[model samples]
Target: FKQAETSFNEALRIDPAFVAASAGKAELLEWQGEYSQGMSLLQPLLAAQTDDPAVLTVYARLLRRTGDAGKGMDVLQPLAESGRVSGAPLRQVRFTLGDLSDQLRRYDEAFCWYKLARQYRPNTFSAAAHRRFIDDLLLRFDSKSTQQLNRSGNNSTQPIFIVGMPRSGTSLTEQILAAHPDVFAAGERSHIGRIVQQIAPLRNPTRAVLARHAHAYLNGLGDSSRAAQRFTDKMPLNFLYLGWIAQLFPKARIVWCRRDPRDTGLSCFTTNFIDPALAFSDELEDIALYSNSCVELMAHWQNTLDLTIFELQYESLVREPESILRELLSVLEL
Candidate 1:
């Protein structure tokens, strides 16, 4: 992060009017939870570059994050409605408008903006391919195969995985766990997904191969992981790899975060995720299809795998955080 900050600063020093550098710095601030600071940094650029899509988008995001959704909407709506922006900027603008509308409880307006945003990006998700992938996962990680594979994996109980559909409180769950001194929050990781891709063609992975993969996963968590009693990987899509997780770390806690499908689908639709794997989120129908597959796969894991999964309901967590968190902590033996 410091390196990034220095680079952005250097870019600005070399060319003070560098819009991209300023915008990138603002984005970095927002990523670091310094929303107000980001807003302040971008404020000067707005007057001169009012129609600049990058500046406007980052500034609007900072506004939204700092609890100024109305201001954000006012700033971005004209550019969006005028249709002056195109390509990635336009898509980002539409998504930001949707976010502002959603924050203001303008559900219909938000949906319209979200739909407009999707029009700029072509949907590339295939339901049949997703179904086939799930089928292959179920076939490869059946109870018998999982049992055979589980015999040789690492027995480390330090790893905790939070998995579910996008926007299903996975982040919230991780945040709560991270509040505990013994738990290190790794945030959303792509290691598991990458590992899955690497081992996809192996019909029968050797015990050494599984061990090596598992070790690589832990090593990827970095040096801070050594200090904490437990570390969390809150990649929502890790739901697809529960069977592999069961085989590799049978003792690791798996918390499945769930929200109302309507809410989940709505949230997924509104947000512009950078991950191409979430291209399924571009359309409501695709979101539903992908969500159903996730539900089915999760149920299969629960019914077949010997592993115990702690189910955390988003609504319940919101309403009764104390009790829910207590139960969750007990389940994790924290």
Candidate 2:
């Protein structure tokens, strides 16, 4: 971490106006939970590079984190307005402005900005492609196949995968679980997805090959995970890879988090999910369709798999965190 900071600082010293270096430094600080430090560095650069959108975004976020949401909104409003007029701003720029508005309690304006942000993005969710994949996987991993194939995976119950749609309280669930002494919080990672991709080309992987896949998945968890009895991968998209996870970690607990479909769609559309692959979230209809597909898939899993899925609803969680958390811990056997 210190080495990275030093390298970033050196790059800035060499070329003070380097936007990439400045953004990299800011990101490094933010990742380390140093919002104020990042803001302090970015704030000065904004005066020199007055029209730099990247600097402005980081500065605005820091301002919001430091309780200067009004100032943050002030910084972003012009950029958002300019982007609207010229159609020049990236989705992130518009999204940051919307977030700032949200922070200032301007719900309506924030929602308007969020919609605009969606317009700026180009990717559309393919409902047909998603449905085809789901149907195909359901056919392949029927109850009988799951019983035969899943038995070959590693028997360790060390991984706890929290799968759900975006903005459906997966992070909150992970946080609550991480509070337990035996649990570790592994933030949203594509380990399981990567495993699926690696093994996808195999026609019928032998038990030895399946064992290798399981080990590779566990190995990817990193050294930090070794300290706890179980660690969580709270990637919401992991909901799509539940069958693979179930096969690899039969004893691993899978928590399916949900929110009211309308609220879930609204939240998904409003939030700026960074992944380019999650572009479906930028459009209302697309996000609604994708979320609905998730609902369908979860239902199919419930009916077909012998797995005991633990459902966590967002509304229930916020209303009764204690009861929900107690039940969550009990489900995890912690």
**Residue 40 deviation, candidate 2, in Å?**
2.7
Backbone clashes in model 1: 0
**Candidate 2 Cα misplacement greater than 4 A, ranges:** 1-7, 13-20, 23-36, 46-49, 66-70, 81-89, 201-204
Clash count for each candidate, listed in order shown: 0, 0
Worst 10 residues of 1 by lDDT: 144-153
Q: After superposition, how far is residue 320 of candidate 2 from its true place, in Å?
A: 2.1
Candidate 2, residues 1-334: lDDT per residue as tens digits? Answer: 6999999889989998788788778978877889978977776677676677777777777787778989988787787667443443467777777888888898998898788777764666677887798787777777777666634457887778788888888988888888888998988887778778877666445677778878877777789888888899899888887777666666788889999988888888877776866877867777887888788888877776655589999899899988988898887788
What lDDT would each prediction earn against the true structure? 0.88, 0.79
- Please, what are the lDDT tens digits per residue for candidate 1 over residues 69-110? 999999899988886789888899998899999899998999
Clashing pairs in 1: none
Candidate with top lDDT is 1
